[model samples]
Target: MGKLQQFLTGLAACFGAILMGSLNVWPSYTLELYTDNTTTLLTAPMSEFESSLVGSLPSLGAMLGTGITGVIIDFFGRKRGAMLLILPIILCWIIIEFSSSSIPILIARFMGGVGGGANLVYAPIYISEMAEPSIRGSLASGTVSLYCLGALLSYLSGWFLSYGMIIWVNLSLCIAALVLLSIVVESPMFLLRQKNEQEALKALAHYRTGSTGSKSVLEELSLMKQQLLPPVELVSVNADAEANEEATEKEKLNTDEVVVVVPPKSSSLKLLLCACGGCVRTGANRRAAFTSNASCRAFLVVGTALTLQVMMGMIAVQVYAGTLFKQAAPDLSAHFCSALFALVLLAGGTVTGIVADKAGRRVLVISSSALVALCMGALGFLMQSGVAPAWVSAVVILVYCFCFNFGAGSVPYVLLAEVFTSEVQGIASMILVEWVWLLNFVLIAVFPFMKSLMGVHGAFYVFACVAVANTILSYINIPETKGLSNKQIQEVLHPKVDKQNSIDASLSVCQKAVFQEP
Candidate 1:
């Protein structure tokens, strides 16, 4: 029952992703329709500038969406924030359905992009927070699969459906997604942070499918509380220790014996210094994630992975797949080949989600990155040599898509979902996702220039090099978070000192300070 509930929650979260996917691909097929005078969809056939805006407006809106979404999710809570995002997408379809002019349609596309951009940030965070550790990766990876499914739906819809019909279909999808999102439970961690312990427990049990009083659910809730709310007594102890010196000076003038306030039952100042130097902390007992050394390091690691994910040319490749297919196989229809491309992407994503937990993140990312490099290298070599048949380049491109999706395509999102402390995950996701959207805009814009300057083969070589770099980085920096709780993962990020040793050392220092000869 817990598994069923979790599955439903993940599916609900992915509706945003589905909407985003369809938005991304909508321009691909509709651009020609809007520009052709024969089509009755627009008041006038769009000029070159207007048509470009129709296609590019969404990216700009996505940039705006990424900027504000972090605050929304944190303030409104993930479930409500996700549902709220769907409104813009619904409005997008409605505007398109009623408007005959290109300006309104262009505005609609931008609104759709806003929703899509928010999805990239919110869906992963919600799924990661709600899922049990054992299946967290699998559930998080579902976003990619469902996004591809949406893209595939758009491709088919554009090929067969009329303009008005496509609008109706997508609007219906957005409405349904909103309805489904309404029923899923709020994130247990968010509930705990609100100090709603009983509600948090029930939410966790619903997702975990355990009794509220069950040991597993209770233990998990306790860990969450430890992370969310530190002990108030420890803060008071620190306060007392600071005032001890003033008290001692006053007592020295008034009494024969100077009373000393013993330190709290934790580690000494020296141990704290050592842990700080080592960048280790025990659970969420640390400072804000942005201020903490451990979290900063984790951010660097995730930032590098995301940079590499974009540099590997996944977006550029997808955008240009039809061109590549047409060059290599003139016999095959480009639209049909594009549908195949979307299907292959869906297949790779599905496989990753199923195997993510069993295979572990590090292994999948490392191995798949290496394979992506190999395929890109071979594709570039074949295209350059001109000795291989045209079909060989086509086959290599398809294989590259599969290999890329197997790891480079999806795992960074999984890592993004899990790496940061909850304190900073929202803002961190916004920053990193904004970076991704910016890169998507930059890469897609510059790719044609790159192909012209370096030639298509040269661009492939560049992508190959990026894949190799990512492979090395992932192996060296990324920790295996599979089946690890948040506390355990943080401990991995910042190794804690031995509790007994820290206590004994702290005690000895306190004794010496209090009893020394004067």
Candidate 2:
């Protein structure tokens, strides 16, 4: 068995995500600095719009960063693209340290958001590519778990440290992460797709070699190469020409002659793109690598599942957990409840890291989402009824925190990395990840108003409804990806052909067939 060397560098790169998660709740932590005259850091306390903008701008910056991530990562390479962000992150801290008013802080947070947004895109994508399928989901889920660790640390600092102190501490962590990131090797898969086979093999061997000998590393590399080039069925190929090519080519051939075409024999970057199904769609011929119908279904499953997870109010919980706790139990300290909420988030994420690969993705998502809905519904009823004990709200909310973080909360991030083929993974991740930021901004912007109008109970009721919808959607649409290779995932998504669940069969296309050279 290979030790998890890939996980260390990937996790180091992901340390920047802690910056994103911490900055998200930055406004909430610093709200009192403006509201309290004694601690006032500003000349004049901000108006609601300014306060909200402080929170919203980071999200907007995140959206901007995510929109361009595909271009930057693909063009500059992942490690280089990530290194370029250190300057902005360092700059964001400098601006915040000198901030005497809302404007400087606003600019700082937005710049920080750019780094935060890119963190989500690169961390998960990098890890998924680094690990083998048997351990891939678990390692990728660690990103989300470590994000919770960042949140917990932020909450701790908020309780005892000043806002300036918090900014300086985060800056130090980013610096340390940069030093660690310097040692990271470029992704082998990325090297392979760029047609740098020798470098790709070297990187792959570095990650894959441990107690295992050189032979196992070579086998893993070959397997990865095979997955990079999937086979297209005869029926799928002929579907593009609508029988026109079949008849025209038939005239030049006899019935005994079989026109066999496979993907290119050379390890060209173009062939890698064709294998991904994304760039394949760019041709005049409409048949994608996995075929069009399968592509559509996979898209819908990922898009709808991730969108629903946000609609269920996970962002609101993360952003406003302290405020919501104040409403739920007036006797308890808001900061204490916030600490507990984050603690549960960390614990739940730890559990996900352990269980994700063992249990299927579909069951975890459906079951956890449903459980969250029930807990939220019960909490709303308890609050509305005016009879529950203060301790009950804490108990109810802690359970909700755990459930939400486990699957409904983290699976979307995992699936976003998993669902798309390599050809479109960059662009697809940009869109989906940005969508997360967009939803976070909208939900946080409206949350105070929603709470004022309906009270906390009413808002919880709305969240519970969305959670219910998420559970049903997961049951109906999401496929289990535990222990399955990308080829297996493609097979599950594309069921139009009489395909079997053989990883070797799907990967053996090039070895089995011949391409008609142009």
Candidate 3:
């Protein structure tokens, strides 16, 4: 296969993964409403605790699901792990659609949450591994786009159908997803790492050549052999070291000129600090500092961006949109208005992916923050005046969603995944995703009370402040990650600072004496 073919196959696989993964989040928007309404219609009276429990159970389940699945992605391999999740998701959908009681519904949603959480970890890792270097940003951005699509689908379903119908529709989507999964190939990296050389070669050939003759297959195999060589040598060294130091030395010698040198225990802490510090420093601390610094900064920026964006966009809007809409247009249906809010969110997420790679994450985030703040400020003013038209209110809300997704929503996951080394990619992505879910939980829980106490307009003004803060932080603290290699991103995020003079000034007599000895 040519480069374009390889890219297209990878892109197809990524799109599929995201589509299935996002299927998990689509039900969240309407699940609470559905649960509450269904319970009230069926039972005599539902308590506040029961209502809250039905609404919040899925999120609690999702937190546990993601935490457990995050640690297992690297072990099970991304493709197999993802495939395993489909069964539970499908089963959950079936139970939710057919089961009678609220308890069954909660269990079903919890099972679905497990699938959703696993998808959050697995889809990005699979996409990042499969994607070509040049188009990786675009591909990574697709994951968020698909997630938004899921949200949109949920909103549309709620707008058009009853609760039972929504459940059936989701069930159908999951069934179709399972059928599609059977055709997709496993990740070549997983096979290679497992020492299934023949299978790995076959998979790579399929990825690279589509279908070719023996000579071409042999050529591809040769290239894979060379590419797989470093890991093989490293594995041998590790295995031999477990046997004895002398065996390790012999194995290292056998690996031609490549030497596997293990540093002393005393150097480990410096290595850790340097790795965690930033990416630009060189010498012994360079590799450690580079990976550590890059991953940490990326996590901080991406996690903060996701948390703030979702808090402002989904949490704030869900809590206050009804009051604000009523104040702006007493005649319009609040349910329809909420559905419109969801549509704008979908539009923002979908469109942002189209331009994110070209515009760059830092620029997109900063610009989006400014736009969101503007729209939010306008929303506050218009709500306070009580004179804004329904159409005007709708436009402002749509524009707010657009700006939020166009900037922060599309960029966070892409930047986080791209800014880390391959060795820690799974764990690093998990950390950021876990933070996103946690912040989402906090925002969802607190926004209603905040809105009640502060009023609709006041709540939005608070979100606007957050946007401005995010913009300033992006400008001062976050570096651009677009089109940069993981190592290069690490370097950019942690530019070198001259600390030698400060060190000299702060040194104590004993430290100075130690420095003199060095």
What is candidate 2's lDDT per residue for 391-427, written digit by digit as tens?
A: 6876887899899889888887777667655655666
Compared with the true structure, all predictions reach lDDT values of: 0.79, 0.72, 0.61
> Candidate 2 versus the native: TM-score?
0.84
lDDT (10s digit) by residue, model 3, range 1-518: 44554445444334433434344444445445545655443443345565456556656666776677655655676665666666666777788667656677668767777666666666677666555445667767766666666656666676677877876777776666555555556666667667886777666666654554467656655644543342211112222234554564455335443333222222323433455554334434322322335545555666677676676655557555666567667787756666666667667766666676677778888898888889888988877786867558757877887788777767776775576555556666666677777887888778778768987778888888888887887787767776765456767765455676322222221222222322
- Model 1 misplaced regions, further than 4 Å: 231-292, 495-518
Candidate with more favorable, higher lDDT: 1 or 3: 1
Worst 10 residues of 2 by lDDT: 233-242
| Candidate 3 root-mean-square deviation in Å | 8.1
Residue 455 shift from truth in candidate 1, angstroms: 1.0
On a 0 to 100 scale, what is the lDDT of residue 351 in model 3? 67
Which wins on TM-score, candidate 1 or candidate 3?
A: 1
Best lDDT among the predictions, by candidate number:
1
